[model samples]
Target: MKKTAYQKELAIKATQKREGTDNNKRDVMKIQSWLTLFSMRNPDSGTATGIDGDFGPATERAVKNFQSFNSLTKTGIVDQELFDKLSSNLKEAFEKPLVGNNLRSLMIEVAENHLKQHPFELEIQGQSNSGPWVRSYMDGHDGSPWFWCMGFAQTILDQASSAIDKNFKALMPLTYSCDTVGNTGLEKGLLSRYQKIRRDPSLLKQGDIFLIQKSRLDWTHTGVIIAVEGDVIETVEGNTNHQGSRNGVAVMKRTRSLRRSKIDVFSIEPLV
Candidate 1:
């Protein structure tokens, strides 16, 4: 099976040494970022390396250590095979075939699969949101500007839609901005505003998306509603943490009270 676009980019970059030459600095940064992500995901990989976009001795040592630990020849280089091992975790999470009777179940399953991989954003070269996971979800674009909660939610929707032979973009624009999503929801008549949802919690179902409203026309964050129980809804949101900040570092499960925050629900009922 083919990997995601970011993985293809990494595979291409992995072919070259990317050894801190002025022209190859960005490529080196990507490789180092993937290595760091792999290490963080698999603590035993021993491939922990700083992402400074310079393939120095420390980077080589990390590559060799990972290779040795994984039973590959200790070449101290990041070849295609080595890169494959490094990215296998994400490939498994994203490419695995899912089975579900409906779009809601499929979306929930897709989000859960990603959660299982422990996707976390990284800061490379002093730039936040520059990481393998962020790139994968954000269409190979990652930086401080790419707050990826909407991107992550859209990705999950796309994955489940693909399984069901549906088009996700028809439901919501492919975007990283919560404002764009909330606007699209309003236009499609699929948006349930905070007041309406507060009165009827059942309007928000599992697999629906929740947008954190900042103002009448502004939404700051979004996530997949995995379960709705009474006044507390459990969500699998990206770019958030235990504190549920919109500018968070990882994909996390959080519980939000319906009465506590100004939230809107984007229903998938139209799709079903």
Candidate 2:
């Protein structure tokens, strides 16, 4: 019997080291492992060019060809998108059901906890902009002014992941850009894509992240779906006050028509 991705024990953790343009060991290892498994998805996807832990020409060509076939830009760079695309099945194969509270419920708890503090917009004040609650996702600028909607979401996951047993980080990329998260879903199978998943809001559960698709290449804003009523979606968003802007002024909860928003939904399976 072949050793499964689960047996490898590495298929669960999201690759943290993304050296986009650097020739590093972690990137090489991640790409090699993904291509080794995902190449088997289709003959043209790419052959297992040996897991020698090298991001050489063979791996680059394989990635580019895979991207071209998948309708992604043939950048030939093994970025987050490429890694997620190649590991969709592998990720699914290793995904275990949440032992207790699902990631959604736990994430909501974290979000609500922050709401308790009534964190508001500070515009230029680094203190309020970089509150202690949302500081974990601030990268290095813990107490500095910065846009924080992404940080809010990621921070929720950070706290929730520790509380529950879900692979929140794996399912949701720990990034500040909603578009990048949406793109990763395209291949990693996070998107509630019509083909693989029903596009019905009725199917959307609480704790799901939705992106406001501004264009083919960009997602302007994001929020956590707290509830869904028919075509209306209630969300908890950060960095905004009212009249939703990409750069909102504070954290607020709001509801809107899903159709008007042109939203893209992403989810992970095995939620308890």
Pairs with steric clashes in candidate 2: 239-248, 240-249, 240-250
- Tens-place lDDT per residue, model 1, 1-272, is 11145555446353535353342666666668777777876798878898887788888888787778778888776666767777776787788889897999988998999998888899876789768888888888888988989888988888888887788877877778889889998998999999998899989899999999999999999999999998899999999989999999999989999999998999988777
lDDT of each: 0.82, 0.59
User: For all the candidates, what are their Cα RMSDs to the real structure?
Assistant: 2.7, 19.1
Stretches of candidate 1 exceeding 4 Å from the true structure? 1-4, 7-10, 13-26, 42-45
The candidate 1 region of ten consecutive residues with least summed lDDT is 1-10
**Each prediction's TM-score against the native?**
0.91, 0.55
Error of 2 at 212 (Å): 0.5
lDDT of 2 by residue, 1-272 (tens): 11121233232233322234456664475566565445544666664565555667777777777778788887767655556666554333223233437667766665666554354432123244532223334553433446677766665565566666455566656677887788887778667743222356666768777777777657777777778787787888887668987666556788867666777777745443
Pairs clashing within candidate 1: none
